[model samples]
Target: MKSLLVVSIVFVLIIIQGTTIGGTRFPTSDENSNEEYTYVEYEEEESSEESTLPPIPTTTSRVILSTELETEGPTIANEFECPTNCKCNKKITLVDCSHQNLMQIPKNLPQSTVYLNLSHNSLKTLNVNDLINCGELRQLYLNNNEIGKIVNTEDFAKLPNLHHIDLSTNAFKPLQGKEFSKARGLLTLILTDNKDIVTSNVPIIQTEKLKTLYLANCSINQLPENIFQNLSSLVALNLDNNPLNLTQGVSAFKPLTELRRLFIPTVPRHIALNLCKNLQVIDIINLSLENHDISCFLLFNNATYEESTIRTDLFKTPTDPPSNSSIVVSTTAPTLSTHIQKGTEVLKQYANAAANQAKTTYEKMSMMYMILSGLVVVLLVAILSVFCIIGSRQLGREISYRKQNYRKYSAGNVTVENPNYERYLIECEKRQFTNE
Candidate 1:
């Protein structure tokens, strides 16, 4: 009997387990029947020069084109007038003068050449005389070369259409502001791995239209306040792996309002968090704030702030008025530490904005207080003056009434309490009759 009962319980348990395991799933499940949901993100305008600078590169001092970053393409015929020991494309447009190991720039380059790859050579200083013929050049690659510096600003000016330049992995001296001043339409510049250019301050990036700039591994420890003031249109910037003091000031990057991507990894988690808090553009895909993704939070917060600012401009027009309550989502809620840091940063910004608002509030309050105080004083003085006038008039009337009563008393009284008028007249009339 016991064996039979145990068998019965075991059979029941197995049936229950099987039902729980496979009952929820449909036997004829069509996986494609599930509806898919997608978010239609607002499409931003495409970059103006996607050809000049590729999407934020991860490698440094390495040519994007590989030795041209020239790995020996098809060798053009001499009929195309290609320079000796150099290779040119079929159309004589993309010239590859790399790996020849010549001391100076090659002569007799094609006039119509646009892309010039002079990298991986032993050329020392780039003289203006060599690049005079390449006027139509657009992209110049001189990375991994011993060339220290270009001759002067006029050399870049000669190439009016020059857009992209890579001078990475070279020995360059401290660059003054005038290095690329004349390159007006310049778009992308790569100066990575050049240690000597970071002596006092960063080379003044004089190119106003510059969109992308790479200054990684240059040991740049200090950043001036207005270093990036003129780079308003810059879209992408890389300053990673450098010994920079990011706590110096956030104003250095303030002018880069149009900036979309940044690569700055400071040591210690809190420092990086603080810097990230101050900086507005931080790509979470490239950086990890304690392994927390703040992209959603930043995007939501930025969108909210921008929408609020526009609304304020359209509805409430004031010449630089401070916003009172604009924090929509509190930046984000990534993790405990990030949330705390973000909260602290929000507090700091609120403190600053509140201070401005408090100043105006305080000023208005003080003015109201003074006006009320002055009104009270005037009212008190008027009340006192009215009482004084009323008291003087009452005193004068009392004095005149007392004098009039005294004159009447003098006429009527012989002693202190006198007599009646009609009785005296009757007595005078009786005395006159007795004398007659």
Candidate 2:
């Protein structure tokens, strides 16, 4: 019974050792042992309870789809392969793929994208077909590209919500029949720096809703006579740097009666003359004129007039009075009649005063001349006295010469001269006889 008791005690010790001690190859800690054995009792109890308990009843809400999903909805950005360094943010619905070396237009752009900037790219032409999906696009920036011409107008016409389009520096050519007429909602069209673009008449047929048209540096030599006929709603028309020859008539811009601001490099003399009746604000920095008839109209800033002849009729009517505005008429033109008349009147007054002064001077000069003549007469009398004295001296020298000759003849020292002396005496006697 002692051995049995001892054996039972040893078996209990072995069981305890087996539970507490790990194998030499495997490591275990006191904290790990406590953690591993403590959850076993609770897990077993929970498992028993779960097996006995009935399953709780549950219900789910029916999935309600959005109304946008029901209809043909707008396209999302992730559907397309967007370029590098560009992200399509769903919250803002913006796709910024600008300044990328994209040769072709990006396809599958989100229809929800309201603003699209494809500027500073290598796009040669605008493929409108690629943008048929962007129905929600309102503002598009296509500046700083090599797009030559707009081949398809239908693509732009389909965008009903499009209002502003910037095609500056794209080298676009002249637009043709109703290309932009279908864009009924378009208000602003920027086509500046398109060197080869020559617009025929203002594209006013469809631009009734357009408020601003920028054609700066578009190489337009002449605006069509009826250009402003269609742009009745236009408030501002920028034609700066365009080679507009306004000599055609002032009526070229006659249709722009409501235009508040006109941007032109030069306003033709005739146009400038008539522009006072039309435009309120005229910006003509490089104005040149063949005639100065329009000098009265150049009462604006930066107004320059090249060397030109002034019309005689300029300011002749006096109907157009000078205003408070600045007038930069070139000094090269002929003076106005009013200026000449004023100058002549002043000069005539000066000449009359000068003639009176001259009359006084002449009277003084005449008295001085009489005094000088008296002095001259006295000097002549003194000179004549000196001349008479010289003449007397010369007569004395001749008398001395004659006395010497007579002495020589009387002394008989000149036997050959005796006959000559006698001949001279006979000649003197004949002269005295003739005188008697």
Candidate 3:
């Protein structure tokens, strides 16, 4: 009878220890504490209303502990359905759990999800464990969430197939070493608009296949020289709006021989000439050159140099393109093309201005010539008027002299009484005067 009572007491102690601490503190199973506490267990009967509904299969179950211990919450399973407020596709994949004013990550996302968009939320932090089950996820959009830190790098590395990750508009500080070293297959990583980023915080990115990296508006002052040494496959690197004074840090791009497109800050004349040698597209953010220097800078692009080559798209297309098309596409880097286009634009602007100025000068010269021609015509007309006045005075004098001579000759002549007698008298007088 005593042995039976002892066994019953031990069994009761086991049950008491098995109960988890909900609101009140309880002794652990192995802990040897002198304090004794009373324990109680309550089981709820299945409601007939819930039983009438069809049963849902569960693949995995996790217990969620809440601060309030009033009642135990329901079990979360792997085959969890979409949340009431969120939208999902018919195949139960591609969940859009954004703008829900959620403070925590949503539970029970479908395992077959390829894309998960959780942008524009009020989340403060992220744990890798929350996303461990999403192995097939390729793109994860977590931009505009107030996430300050991401704990557990291992959880992120578990997703081998994840290619694109957007963590823009967050509150992240500098990252640690190889922050995403496990994401070997990652192709693109965007961390734009996180103003607290520092160069050291940029993880030692070890991915050889990483192609594009965007760090715009991250307050990055400078980049470590060797930060991109391992990224042999990188094609595009956007550092727009950062304060990287390229004059002091041109070596930052020495290792990026395969890089095709680059977006940088204000580039000095010497630096721009050298830096733009290999790049296809250079989207400069804040240009600080003078107007005269702008012409000089653009003219420098005419200098020819060796250009870097690019890789072709290995992923096969749905329809077969031409045989040599892929090879031609890969090797054709726009390095020279972009420079020619940009230089052409700058030169074209200057050409248009020069043409307009020439037109204006021609118009001014035409007006001056017209004024001079008018003056010359006025001078010629004044000289001709003066000569005509002098000639008219001379002619008047000659007429007066001729009139006097004619009057004297008429007075000397005698008047005849008869026409025949006057003629005989004039002839006799003229003959006598001539003989005298």
Candidate 4:
């Protein structure tokens, strides 16, 4: 009777077990579907949040060129007859005899030569006899030579049409007594890299038509007062790489009323302001200033201040006075301080604009870095989640397989007479039959 009762109970448990196994299979399928849904939701949320971020600034298509073209090309041969150890153009208007070991000027040059280059040679002195015939010469380059002194002022003064001269990198002595007076029609002069002239004051130049002067890298310490008084028409002056003491007076440039461009040495802010007060072209390279001076320079706005300070005349037009009656006209111009203030404002504006551009570029780079960092982090999290999910599913499957195997072995080892063991055996056999 106990065995029979056990068989009936076993039969009931087999039916229930089969139903529970079927129900457990539905849950695994549901878990798989939930995993897919979670993945889709995570991707949508990530994309939607990232898309809401502000777009970075970009250059316009109109400004960006599609392709870049190179301007460099191979050299072409000249068609004109060139002199031995010299180069000349097709029209024979210029001659180049540079880098040659000759001590004297080349003879029998074309009569139409207007530009002559005899630089980088072993010449020590310039003789009048050498250039007496080239009257039409306009530009002469005698730089990089051993020329220590000019033979006479009259030798260079002979060329009435000479306009430009370059005597840079030469060892010249202090010129005295009306030197360069003959070359009064000259427009430009370059005497750069001459160390001897820096020891003493250079003699007053008397060129009436001289417009440009370059004395850079000359090691000059001080400029004599009224040094530029005679250069009324001078437009550009380059005094860079000089060692002018800040304590000394800088009145040398005061006489340059018509000067347009100035390249002075690094000096105190006050001195630089005083020297470049009236100039239109001022280079900031040679300026040495303290932090407070920079603040002061940036704070002053000359244009706005000048406009407010200046008073406009109420009367639009004055009635014409009798020509013979003396009508005095006020000749006073704007003060030097006004001009200095105005120039400083322009430089400050340029500096501010450059600073703003740099800040914008930095911000853009930071944004890009942040975006890349976020993407890397998201990718790592996604990979870790995938690995974790796979590992958990594999562990669950192993545990379930081990439990089933343990039940099967225990039921097979149970005593045949035990009703409980018999009941478990029936359940196991029924499960295997269902699987089959």
Scored by TM-score, the top model is: 1
TM-score of each: 0.52, 0.45, 0.47, 0.46
lDDT of each: 0.58, 0.53, 0.54, 0.53
Residue 434, candidate 2: how far off, in angstroms?
99
How far in Å is the alpha carbon of 181 misplaced in model 4? Answer: 1.1
Stretches > 4 Å off in candidate 1:
1-54, 57-80, 201-203, 267-285, 288-436
lDDT of 1 by residue, 230-326 (tens): 7877877777556667666555776776676565533333344444454565333122111122232333344222121101112223553343323
Model 2 agreement with the true structure over 1-436: per-residue lDDT tens digits: 6445544554454333223211111110101211110000011121131122111101111011111111122323445434344444443234555568777777666667665667667788887777777787666667668888665677776787676676777866666536677676666677777776666654433555666677776777866776567766565566756667767645666666456445455565545545555554332222222223332233332233331223322322456333222445555664543333333444455568999999999999999999999999999999999999999999989866665446243334543343456666787899999999
Q: C-alpha displacement of 356 in model 1, angstroms?
A: 24
Q: Looking at model 2, which ten-residue stretch has the lowest summed lDDT?
A: 34-43
Q: In candidate 3, what residue range of length 10 has the lowest lDDT sum?
A: 55-64
What TM-score quantifies how close candidate 4 is to the native fold? Answer: 0.46
Candidate 2 contains a number of clashing pairs equal to 0
Model 4 regions more than 4 Å off: 1-84, 198-204, 277-436
lDDT tens digits, residue span 306-369, model 4: 2212111211126522223132323332342443444444545666888999999999999999
How large is the C-alpha RMSD of every model relative to the true structure?
20.9, 43.4, 30.1, 37.4
